[model samples]
Target: MQPWFVYRKCSNRSCDMCIYFLVLFASVCLQVQIKREKALDITSEHLIKAMADQMANEGWRELGYVYLSIDDCWTKKQRDPNGRLEPDPDRFPSGIKALADYVHSRGLKLGIYSDMGNYTCGGYPGTTLDTIKTDAETFSSWEVDMLKFDGCYSNDTEKAIGYPKMSSALNATGRQILYSCSWPAYEGGLPPKVNYTQLGNICNMWRNYGDIQDSWASVLDIIKWYAVNQDVLQPTAGPGHWNDPDMLITGDFGLSYEQSKAQLAIWAILAAPLIMSNDLRTISQEAKDLLQNRLLIYINQDSLGIQGRQIMKVDCLGVWKRELVNGQYAIAVINMGDDGLPRPFTTSLGLLNVTQCPVGYKLYDVFDRNYLGLFNSETTFNLKINPSGVVMLFIQPASVVNHMKRHGSYFG
Candidate 1:
């Protein structure tokens, strides 16, 4: 089922730039309402616990989905008289510090959200230029491991100054907060318009596109944008600095089972952050299984950290490749069509610019969890991909494949 959407009128003193935040507010509310239905009045605190317990017990945390982020609207509508951000009394009576402690106790990290303007997108209190230091210290004191600093109710010049200043403020706190910036997404996520080198210096990851909605169309739109801008986005992404395509809406109302798998596969291939924005308590078993896919998660967390690039696109089918540690690669063939049938296609590694290995590479299916055998660069891989689905393979050199099999470690 889809979540109810909320629309809050822009009530901040900032200029007309707030209209942009109102739109983002309405979209993010969809995901928030879904979680609310799962936990009712104890939504904020109990929901975090539920997510933490699930992540720990269900093997998701071990698979590298560590951070449980609290998004907009978690704060009070107005700051305390001392100009400090406070958790909403009605929603989070135990407060954000207690929540962060609980998350850390579960061997997980906590991420909180705020804006770089007078108010958050959800109309909650935000950090202005004068209050940046206070908010940064508050987050550190609460033991917040990450901060998703959003762009709302502010202009370009304010963003340019505020983003860097906030980074400095965060560093001064002497806490290791993973800064997720929205500055570039507001500036069109490209060079001249977006200074990625500056972003890399400030943010650990940055959103590069519109917020993802819970639908196959929304997923397709994001993938298409990344493909179109691959040359620009790919090089800028690496170990600590990543190009976020927004959250994983898998197991939510919008995508089919195939589409859910496709989303997880492609997100891993892109080396994007695997932040799930769905209700964990009610997710379907199929969706749960896909979220916990070990091979896919391993490929995503590869030490190489190179972002994948789209190699070919033919009508409904598109192929992408990411270089991995130990000379391996992750290749994804996605079908983004709606013809209601799986499309059969063929391709070779040579066409993907993969040079011949001393011994042919072994093709292992990430979702199916089966080895498709060794193939040289000239060998054609015939594949049938479901509409709005994907076929993800890990290409490992024979030497490493033999060593992994010998040690009984397949996804290593």
Candidate 2:
């Protein structure tokens, strides 16, 4: 079988991992808008700046969590007198340019939100074809590093035209702003409706499913959708492009500890973007550890960039595997049962598609950070996966490690 060559290493300064956080601060403001709270204490500038500061202070910046994104409701309900979009004076007194400057000073990139329709999802002014050039230029001028263009209040025709138009418009500005599109998600996220080739040509990443709500069921739904659509989605994802399953709500409400690990592990296997939609200010320590797990992040950002596939699924057990550079592989076994007990599962290297391991395969339990000993093609391994949980392992062939060491190249 030919290995899917969708991933390339990002050589640009900030695009290395492109790990980002769609701050839950934006979610809170959206809730405030729905509740009609006009005078919230956390201003847009404060919220975004605080997130950037936390990334810097908490070591998240070093982990490649560099893009700090501001979602909807950051703008005034009305455009300025000149028709250019303006930040809400009360919420963003310092203005977006200044905020972008601040984020950049911390070595972080700033991502802003907008819609390709008459109005944003929150009913703020959106960018139409007429305003696409102006909005793109404005964002570039502000040094915005990323744009999360949403699909709201727009029909299919408008999206088809506007999405690529905006991509071209952003390119015309001469700034390298990452385009995060919601096109596929709105167009059923399937082959007939979504042109994966065209999407890869234009977008840096795309949402391919419904918004991930804060629930175990929501996570499972996304996992199932991506797993079922892996063949189509995997081939299009690589260094510059990715299939976004929406935000990681792991650190937020509605997930248990094991469930959080499952979300993180599977997202890594899928090579999906690790955009956290949780409140960084008050996230629990356990949740924070999972979010900042370096081993998982390494797998997710592997240069090989091969999106994992569901090797097998039977009853409550689902297995996934992603190929990595240096002949390494990642395997994730998830228990989707809700029976409140660990499900015992058994499998071997041969079943996992390991055709050959000349000196046996050394397995490392990434979640527990333990060495699980060496095994071969027929070596059987047993796992007791907790309900609503996952166990992820990294497989490295001993022969490859020995060969690399003989050649004086570091394999670890």
Candidate 3:
């Protein structure tokens, strides 16, 4: 069999064989160890501090969030005289390293943004092909924990070359930095030129679609796109690699309380990254509660790491189910309508594609944090879904450890 390594002169046959096995081992088992991203937009230091505080202290860290990322516009309009990217002196009074230190002090990692072209999306300096390695070193020097590399202002050829080159440069830094790319998104998210396998090997997580504005319409569009294309998207996400659905707008305006819940619940079900991007300090208490929902976070962080799919959708009612690490399932009953009234919906084990869903599952309501009681395969589960809301549940199978077995219906 051909070796996985690039051609290199072997010192000896044993050395060559050793190199081959090591490369093979890494190819098979070394995942990037990056699975979450909480992307922030260009903002002042105070706002970034607030987001870091919320993510670290307000119950999101325990949910497996690893990086608190800053998106575009963190830098000045031009590189410094030394050809190094510099943070806006006024916005970041303490500099990028200081901000990174603050985030680290809060028990969180810091992420900064860059573009593969001449300028970032916000018209700030970028890490174009000429500066890719320098930019990588700059981020590493700043002790940045992650990078959200955008594909703005570049031709297809430039992106195809620059994106991978940047990834290589990052690896060469010898620092444990996660790479989040917009390459696949610029390539239109699939097929012809999009190579998911290579992406998994290169990028830790990648934006697969458009940016999410702070609105329900944008959220709905992303959901719809993922639902239809999950066949190609789901298999590509797990552990170190993921399909980013952009930042979470849970605590932001443009979505009602119920609509925010839908966004959070659907994101959890999709096993997507929990990168929240909102004004955390000024966010409503209700939005904060939903954004930091423990059950939803647990489902999102489930080690099974399976992205959910829209198994059933009729009109505005839909069901999305994600297999969890515990042999249970995280399911979301979503109402897509805005009729200003609650809608009653129903589904069974078969409809959920659970096939032979056992009778001992203790379906717990994730939103209400109450037991919905045990159910059987033939059980008819009903939910009163609010308009543009979701009822996410964790149907935990009765285990020998929990001893929740009661072979029949057990309603509250």
The per-model lDDT (C-alpha) reads: 0.78, 0.81, 0.72
Cα shift from native, residue 299, model 1 (Å)? 0.9
Best by lDDT: 2
Question: In model 3, where do residues sit more than 4 Å from their true spots?
Answer: 1-42, 54-57, 355-359, 403-412
Give lDDT tens digits, candidate 1, residues 1-412. Answer: 1111111112211111100000001012223446655534445687788878887787666556677887877776788999999887756778889988998899778888889988888777878999999999999999997789999999898899999988888878877677789999898888898998887777777999988888899999999999998988898987667889988887779988889988888898898877787777788888888877767777776766788988889888989898987888999999988878899988877887776576778888888888898888888989999888899998888767464456334443
Q: Which ranking of candidates, highest lDDT first?
A: 2, 1, 3
TM-score of each: 0.89, 0.91, 0.84
Per-residue lDDT tens digits of candidate 2, residues 11-49? Answer: 321233333432222452455444334444554688888
Of the candidates shown, which would achieve the greatest TM-score relative to the real structure?
2
Q: What lDDT does candidate 2 reach at residue 1?
A: 9
Model 2 whole-model lDDT (C-alpha atoms)? 0.81
Worst 10 residues of 1 by lDDT: 17-26
Count of clashes in candidate 2: 3
